[model samples]
Target: MDNQKPSSGGTFKKFIIALVAIVILALGITGVVYYLRWFGPNVTDKQEYLYIHSEAGFNDVYQTIREQGIVKDTTTFLWAAHNMNYVGRVKPGKYRLKEGMSNRKLINMLASGAQEPVDLKFRGLRLKTQFAGYISKQIEPDSVAIISLLDSAKFVEQYGFTTENVYTMFMPNTYQMYWNTTSEQFFKRMYKEYENFWTPARKQLAAAINLTPIQVSILASVVDAEALHDDEMPTIAGLYLNRLKRGIKMEADPTVIFATGDFTIKRVLNKYLSTPSPYNTYRNTGLPPGPIMMPSVNAVKAVLNYKQHNYIYMCAKEDFSGYHNFATNVAEHMANAHRFQQALNERGIKK
Candidate 1:
């Protein structure tokens, strides 16, 4: 056995080796911590969306995330957010929280302001309030904001519309837009779509028919209201147009129902015709000041391409097939009306 006292130099060398090993271990652990903070999967399985309003701050966003538990290991996410400087760059949007997304990717997306879009859709809106309410549900603004914008005479004038007629500017369609769209922005987009729809050819057709775009929309709403089946729209539209050309009162029962504010009125009685409202076509000589409802594209086209006929009157068909009976004279119309009244009486649909 060659036993000898260990030299001081040898002892120091061992100590140095141990120190290097410790340093390497520490570096390995630190690397893992950093990687977990930045690159680890932070979005939880609870996969939901994150909706930040137009004017939200980081605190509001964080509070929502924290309260909703939208993420996993928020501790590491917070650290990464601070380190990556995402706290100062909060973007308002609808963010889809994808599963297995790392903190770095989420932070980058937020910082870069890349947000998902929303599909906004509406149809058969009978009133301006209904339109506003339906639109508000999918966007950041409230119904009050939409109603205020629609009611503002000055604001609507730029779009070549009056407060009463501005409702016609919005065509029923599925519009892909941002969730944070402001009310003004929504109106601007709708106006753009409206312009796109009313092309030069349609404009010429409207002019040839002696009706403005707003008037066409008004008539389309009435046509849509009277015809439950789309196939009957053209004939119904022609009948109303003929009535208009002949200077005949529309006597639209739908308008009477609208004026009464009783949407449940199954039968437009004589008393309901007396309802005092500008919307009551039974009293008004021409198209009402605004549309009774948001008109469909089909109904609108039906007005533009109305079937040429001598029909000046119409009533719902007696068979309840959602079709109408057309007439060129009041005697025929009265007979049709009597049949419809008899049907109504048999069905007990009295208001």
Candidate 2:
């Protein structure tokens, strides 16, 4: 065989090819690692709402995330958060985590403060305690936090409300607000909403009725509680207005039930009516100091535009149809009351 010297050029070319291949492989592997750290699915299936408290620092948020096991790999998430500049910017909110969300997307959501809103709807909440408890479940602040403002005479006075009448500020509606809203912020927001609700026209209507906006709301609460059907609110409101003009006691059984602090009472008894409270309209000659419950819009409007009539007394229909029978005298009212009482007895609704 003829001996040929191995060409140096050929040998160099093979070496070059191997080196390039190795370099390309190394680069590909690095790219994959980077992708895993930055763009890969990091959120775990344990996806639940993450409530970042108001004014929470980065550490507190990170600790919450870590403790909750929100990410598949904590180390990778930490690296991604730092690299994406999400470490320093921590926003408080109610965040919902989706399964298989990339690390970058997760960091972006938290850093950008893109939070979910809570739906706060209040209707027939009879007590401040009930209202506070309802609010606490939707927001970060506890019930105690809300009650402190509701009961603070000085705080409520600044908003043109007394501690006893602060409930009038919040009417029945679905309010959209952030979960991180502080208690003070909630009160301010409700006051703003209240102000918006009482427009100049509505205020004029309230003035024409010989009542302030708050007094109207207080009367509306009684109307709201007494009338199960919205259509009857106007007639019921007129009856109460007649009583107001005649210097007669309201004798609102709902007010008496509210005064007793027992919402479970299906029928108001004499004992319950005798409960000692400023809210008890039975002994009182006018509307209670505050709203018995958060008034509905219909009820509030009913008071403002109450039908002109001589109906000074009203009673629930004995048929349990949630309607009330109107009367102009105590005799007719007592007859209506007797029938309702018999119905209540038949139904065994004794309190």
Candidate 3:
């Protein structure tokens, strides 16, 4: 009986040991499966990148980044990002990354901010038009809101602009800005760009010509409207400069057309020329209060470095090519005008 009892006790100890081994082995298998599924070969350890425009939602951003293979697991990435308090830090813009970037690194990049270049060309754009384009493509600010902000007199005091006109301040060029940049920041950056463009030499030239930078910009906008070819800009600018010096009304048909804000190439009727606007050069003398459109740098430079000439009048030649006939006297201008009119009549165009 004593031997049997000792044997029974050893058998019971063996059974307990076997049961503990089974449990430990099961746990190890479970741990291996979990690790394989969550952190194994499929896990992306490299960086990844994606681009998002302004006003893009966060979920859209997540999906984009995931599709770009920036994040290995969407759920895990989101969880980590959220846990690390990066929910608000992910700005809307082009983001660069590689697979396997740590969540911390991603978060830091997001927090550091991303900048994108916005090419706002001054290619014959008025202030309202430029602002409209800027709001549409880049900042997504409300048009009415931006206009109201521009119209507010306080902006002048805040920005140190002498003119009430907001369009006079923006220089047309390719500008770089953060994707999440505010409208205020955009305007501030534009002001800085304007300051940079208006260097001491440019200011001196503008003053020497008895024109403000804004006035030069306004004249450049007119030159941009009138001159079909870039090469003709300096000569055309000289014609207008002489006319201005002589205190003659520019009588530019382009200004009349620009006053209506219609770009049709049809003949300018007397009614169209009579359209009442401050921008109408036929109706008003000298430069308009501001630019009709954003002028190119070359056009602005053409106005600043205008050629010296006694020419006071210009008309498109009868050839209908892009060249113009410049005249110092009324008789020559009338002859050229008659020839152009004759050509227009032959083409069945009524002017």
Which regions of candidate 1 deviate over 4 angstroms? 1-17
* Structure candidate 1, residue pairs in collision: none
Q: Cα lDDT for residue 161, model 3?
A: 55
Candidate 3 per-residue C-alpha lDDT over 236-325 given as tens digits, one digit per residue, 9 for 90 to 100: 999999989889998888878778878774688778878899878888888877677777888889999999989998989899887899
lDDT on C-alpha atoms for all candidate structures? 0.90, 0.90, 0.75
Models 1 onward score TM values of: 0.95, 0.94, 0.76
Runs off by more than 4 Å, candidate 3: 1-73, 87-108, 111-122, 140-142, 160-164, 348-351
lDDT of 3 at 152: 70
Residue range with the least summed lDDT across 10 consecutive positions in model 3: 40-49
lDDT score, residue 330, model 2?
Answer: 78
* Candidate 2 Cα misplacement greater than 4 A, ranges: 1-9
List the candidates ranked by TM-score, beginning with the highest.
1, 2, 3
Residues 229-306 of candidate 1 have per-residue lDDT tens digits of 888899988888888998988989999988988898887889888888999989888888898889999999999999
